[model samples]
Target: MHTDRVYVVTGGTRGIGAAIAQGLRDDGARVCVLARQPDPAEGVAVDLADPSSVPAAFERVLDRWGRIDGLVNNAGISKVGPSLDYDLADFARILDVNVTSLFACSQAAAKAMAAQGGGSIVSIASMTSFTGQPERAAYIASKHAVLGLTRALANDWGPHGIRVNAVSPGYIRTDLTTDLIARGVLDVDAIEGRMPLRRFGQPSDVVGAVKFLLSAEAGYTTGQALVVDGGWTVNGYFK
Candidate 1:
């Protein structure tokens, strides 16, 4: 359904970003995977943490595809530590890659999409976008900013036919989290018990929401954050 549509998926080298890229490609979109370590056959290698390099990386996408039909701001980094010990440099880098670059990439893609009539942008936010998690100050802050950015862009670019939206995935079983689980840093059973679905989500679970938002089917949707969690946000504890 997305045949010939060119999409730029940041941090598409692995995990959720890779899943999104593969899903889009499977459905026929020409997917460009942008990362610090990119696959030559996929797309350019650019460090999103370095904001200065963002535009040119995007430009490379345009150079190859001629135009951008969609963008998935899926690349991000997270540092887990107490707020007191949260290194300033780590915080800044997280914001640079997660929030700042997301905006820059979206802006670049929006311009191209606008010039070509219209396009869709789906950013990967987190369940943290809405709720606070322990020792994730920077990540939570960046995600909140991402949702805000999504809304702002939707408002700013709606007239140009650009739809800006986000996907908030709950504790998905990614390589990162899998490692955490293996190290006993996270309790899989405990997490699953808290979820209404009684299980953790998979990267593929979030991909469908993103694809829908980017497709013509969600033509009327904009400035919305679709939560792909298993009822984590909606679960409230009893007194």
Candidate 2:
């Protein structure tokens, strides 16, 4: 369904971002990955934390692909510590990369899409967007901002045919999560038992939802946060 279309995925070097990029390519889209260390063949090196680098990366995509049909804002970072003792710099840096850079990328993509009459943008939000977890004050706040930005952009750019939406995942098992579990930061068994699905989500579990949002099938969808959590957020009863 994505034949010949061009899509850009930020932080596509690994994990969920890489999965989404590969999924898009499998459906025949031309994929460009933006990352700090990108594969020379199919990726563009861009430091999203650097404000000036965002526009230049998009420009490079436009220059190479001629037009961008979709953009996946998947780059994000987090710092875990007691909220009271959290480093101020760490909190600011999280917001800079997750919220600020996301907005910049969306602005760049929206400009290109508006000129071409239409496009889709999907941001990787988090279950934190809806509810807070311990030691994740900054991450939660940034995700909340992402959801708000998605809605605001949809409202502002609807006239220009730009669709903005987000996908919020819960406890997806990626390399990062693996490290967290190994370091005892996360209790994998407890998490799985609490989740209705009784298992952690694989990165591939999110690919389908993301592809749907980016496809023509979702033409009428915008400003929505689709949760791909295996029912983790909805189960209220203790297991």
Candidate 2 per-residue lDDT over residues 100-211, each given as its tens digit: 9999999999999999999999999998898988998999999999999999999999999999999999999899899989999899888898898989999888898899
**lDDT (C-alpha) at residue 95 in model 1:** 97
Computed on alpha carbons, the lDDT of every model, listed in order, comes to: 0.92, 0.93
Off by over 4 Å in 1: none
Per-residue alpha-carbon lDDT of candidate 1 for residues 85-178, written as tens digits (9 for 90 to 100)? 8899999999999999888899889989999999999999988899898999999999999999999999999999999999999999999999
Question: Which has the greatest lDDT?
Answer: 2
Q: For candidate 2, report its TM-score.
A: 0.96
Best by TM-score: 1
- Model 1 — which ten-residue stretch has the worst lDDT? 230-239
TM for candidate 1 is 0.97
Candidates in order, TM-scores: namely 0.97, 0.96
Candidate 2: residue pairs that collide:
none
